[model samples]
Target: MSGIFKKIESLVEKGKEAHAKTWHNWAGNIVLEPELIFHPKSLNDLQEIVKKAKKHGKKIRCVSEGHSWSTLSVTKDYLVIVRDMHQIQVEKSEKYGWTITAEAGATIKQMDDKLRQHKPPLSFDSMTVLSSVRASGIVATGSHGAKCAGASISDQVVKLQIVTGDGELHVFSDENDPKEMSAARINLGLLGIMYKITWHVQPLFKLRMIDFQPPIKSWLYPATLKEFVEKSDSVEVFYWPFNESELDRNDDKLWVKQWLRTDDPITTSQAELGMERVCEDLETRFGDKLYQFIVKCPESTPYITNLLWKAGPVSKPQNVVIPAPDAIHYQSGIDNILCDDLEFTFKADKDFANVAEEFNHIVDSVYAYAKKGKFPMNLAAEMRILKASPSLLASGYDEDPNAIYCFIEVLAIRHTSGFEEFSAELATRWMKKYKARPHWAKAWEHVPGIKPYLREILGKRLETFESVRVKYDADKIFFDNKSLEEVFYGSPKSTFTESHL
Candidate 1:
């Protein structure tokens, strides 16, 4: 062991300090070897980690599952893993109704299971499709579901607790400070290491998911798209691009997944969605080999994608009614298929004119690039409609009560050649055309001049976030990454020594 490793081991208890091993994100894209890594278990342990980092003049960053594609969790000095703070408490208040207070490290699946077993049963209003992620991590990164009436996951946060860089525990709630709550809701880990988060939940509900295939020309029209979104409680669209010759029909089709609130009894044995499909078996058996081939050949992507689509759930129309948790998290084992993803969220007009126009533009652009012998995207292009969020830094944030947000993303298998250039070009186009904001947790750092663009586009919100951020972390311990500094402060700067503790 090196001198640094020996010193780090001496600082923490035996099992708490991780050996100086390199850490990588789920997609294996970003890798870092911090000077020291600690898995603190309790609130006191979190505070102690912060205090020690301050004493050693080392910067600190917290991570949970490392699902983010961005460098927000990067820290060369100290990396704190909060996963051991797993605790769950569900309570009902006369004023607050149903609320669940979960520790930062608790997984969404854990919360869902506990809520399902609750006396009355409860669940989140909106959530991401993957239940394996940490609840607080998803909330901090502004993850969202397809609920047209529901906002991003952060909007469900009613109270938050964190240990700031000063080694002091602070709590923010609407009852105490709404402004701070807004900033803390989707903090991007700049403020501090969050230890506990409380969210307002709802009684469990059932939903019927109707999957169908419709011709692209008719289904994606602005007016028609608006009708489907408005009619369903949640709508998700997936398009796997293909060359005209590969399709059996003249025009390609879209797979539309619509979820509606249902009073019908729930399916007693709800199998994981898409698990029973034959395509899933093929994917599990040959996904890696196929992905490797696509990465090497690149040109074979279209044909393989088309075949996968035919064998996928969309190939046949079907309907199933399941409880809210199952419906919200429809798919499983997605993280197993590593990929590079970039998502954008922008305001949509009531008629969805902009949504229709931009989505079609993207579809056309994909084929256009392929014709030029460039395959930047080979996987599904997904879109979801959601209501506005109150979190200041959230991509879906807006003041209008009726405001709607269009969430769309382009994905390519990880390490694909020309993918970065392709995604950057398309991202730039979307930014210029619709003032689209990229999801903070996804890939956007590579986009040309992303920092300045975000600074300019998110002017007032950035200013508000900076103000609240300094109150908790005046020394900038958590603000330790280049990407965040460039976007938030316009450039990299040194940390101030004044302590709030």
Candidate 2:
């Protein structure tokens, strides 16, 4: 045997986590079988896998939960599952405050379970609704909470331990290595596999979640939306697009959800968390029959949308007060139906910004789609408020670091035929009209003009990220496939088909 082959073979045995397997993400939307899927149990185990992959001229991708809709985690050669590396060490300080250093594979749920056990307890300013997502996955992809007081999940990170393509473990922090830290904060799994994530946490606090179905006039008027967000700890609004025609209401209506820091204390559990009962009522009580009927002929989108609001438990107004974790999350309930989601962010510093304008246009398209016999969207469009971010890759581009931004999510239900094409049209318009950017984890990478839009908005920050990327993984050994290539390299193949636009 050749000397090089013998050396590579020896290194392969050192990577005990390696194995062959067929795998699918949690949502079952994406599936892939890698030649070898490695579940590293420790930092050393992870380093060994990287060393072997680099030696053998193989590519690697790290995945946890695989919640992202994009093909970012898809790879044929090597897949590294870091969940087994779960571990954590926490520290409290009089000067720096509470800091928790958790292995990348650890989950938000796990962190909350442990941190809340502290004498004073601790929690993140915001967190994704799905607690099962890994800390590494969410932070690396820039997952966010609905709170405007906090930045993307990545922004909470104070330090990171990463195993780069060359199998070296490097720790970078915002204070000491701002440039490197900026890139590592939202590393995109390109620099390397994250081994440990350290975050700054706040003292455990109580929050109240209130549900309001305000009249359409309230949401349509920019003044109301601004007040709702400015007064609440966090605010989210859901607009039922076909409401005017479907519900037979005088004007459109929105499910306005607001969360506020409360002295009310944690005093809720079971049969009353409210969300479970709400989803149940949605399926059984108020509008189940109507919703099911509309499902058969989604062309009657107005009916389905009406059924959604009617079925919801918040007929008048409802309130729930719970622990910080429970209050921050809800069932995202994204999977029950096959669908595609597209998200865009507008500046909206003090008010709706360009959103008020672009929103009107999209509403027009909703009517056009329905008029052309296109399926009407069955789910509510989600609106979230994001404060200015320190993470360079945050959708806002960090231009106005202190400015507030609003994230709007448009859901395209699969039950309705040709929703993907319609979504593509909406996403395309967002980038061109608002000069918006998509949340990294969702399905917006395919939108046309994405790279150019990001390039123009990000400016020097993009170049800095690219330079730091090259510094960490000079060979791009972690480059998994064409999907990753399209993002980092800006290749033409990574974009959506023009026809979809």
Candidate 3:
């Protein structure tokens, strides 16, 4: 046991911290102190530790930036911190095009910066979490944007090198095997520790942005869905809470924005100011009065931006072009704003009407609670579109190759005080009513019936995933956490007990 610690110490002599406090999650809600925290410098070092941990029957949890809104990364046993596994190497391929191999620990921003060095460059549509923190190889779940044509980062992965629970290294790709490819893409950190990933990249391009605010009454309802589908490359709607009577009569507004591939040069100053101005307008329109009232306002920027649309006639679109990486998405000023959870999707099939009804039910229910003073002070719903991909776990499941993604975010101002309770209840309702599944990385728990719902919705794909899991993780080496067990194995209680190495 002491030898295991010594080996880890040798690899990460400086970053290691003993008796360290359990890390806080991205939402700042849950924290757990692992028995030991090890940062392995190389894949070999990781394999060494995995070998020892398996021999001694120790449970392991691999952590990245700890940006998950859920407890998936929490562990009380052996925790592998892979922040030092950062490396970016690109190679040109004549057959499959450009292949970029990166260590899982590299941040998305770092990868984007490196890709820009190419002649034509390469780019990803969105980023997960903040760029400063080291991102885990898993892409840290639930980090997606509103590009219907784009897939989650995991979907871009072409190959991966993972260390199985027994410390055996397996290089998986589509050409070598299909089972390995499916499981490796979503791995859920359950197969083993992912060491390296290779992804397919497109030559760099610019993204054009046009921001508009439109009245909620004019846009979000069933009537506008068709027009929304045809008019934009990517469209998102955000709603705010104000006097319901006033809003119903045309007071509340919606912010709509679109992004398309373009040939324009990047606009750094305009992008920054656009975000700041959006924030400022939100603060100005709502004022501190709403915040003090503890009223859950629609995220100020989106709502205010929407109001701006109603203030004038819709005209020629305003255009702003920036580097694809920089222009991909914006962090609405709620940096401190924490969500109980978020769920969005890429597929809206026959289930669209049913899902829409369920969504409206939840919204109406929340509003009813607010009217009764039973609602928390912060919460908002957002809707967006996405194009489907091959990744099994991707939200854009198989409705259409290109489908709209809708997001409903329940933000919590105070962690305690009914916010958590309400959000949990709402999640359960969503699962029961819409057969909805929560994002793996967001704030959601595996309720009793969730697995069956997933199986029913995902059909044979779910069975295929299980078959793949059985092949890669016959012993369940990566099933160390309760949440993960619930997600993969449908266990109401975890069977694997924690053992120290």
The C-alpha TM-scores of every prediction are 0.93, 0.87, 0.79
lDDT of 1 at 447: 82
lDDT of 1 by residue, 1-501 (tens): 699888876655546778767888898999999988898889888888888888888999878988889888898998988888889999998878999999999999989988989989888887888877897789889988899999988888888998887899999888888899899999888878898999999999999988988888767898899888989999998877773345333377888899999999765454445454334545545766676788889889888877767766555566888888888887655766789999988899788998887778778877788878887887768999999887899898888867998998888888988888877777777777667889999999998877877888888888888999888888888878998887877744322112200
Tell me how far the alpha carbon of residue 128 in candidate 3 is from the true structure, in angstroms, after superposition: 4.0
Total clashes for model 2: 1
Arranged by TM-score, best first: 1, 2, 3
Q: Which stretches of model 2 miss by more than 4 angstroms? A: 1-20, 241-250, 267-296, 313-316, 332-338, 414-416, 452-457, 491-501
Model 3 residue 467 distance off true place after TM-score fit, in angstroms: 3.0
Per-model C-alpha RMSD: 5.6, 4.1, 6.6
TM-score of 2: 0.87
Model-by-model lDDT, in order? 0.83, 0.74, 0.61
Note the residue pairs that clash in candidate 2.
Answer: 216-252
**What's the residue-level lDDT of 98 in candidate 2?**
92
Show where candidate 3 strays beyond 4 Å: 1-21, 129-143, 243-250, 265-318, 332-335, 344-346, 349-363, 377-379, 399-407, 414-416, 424-429, 446-460, 487-501
* Top-TM-score candidate index: 1
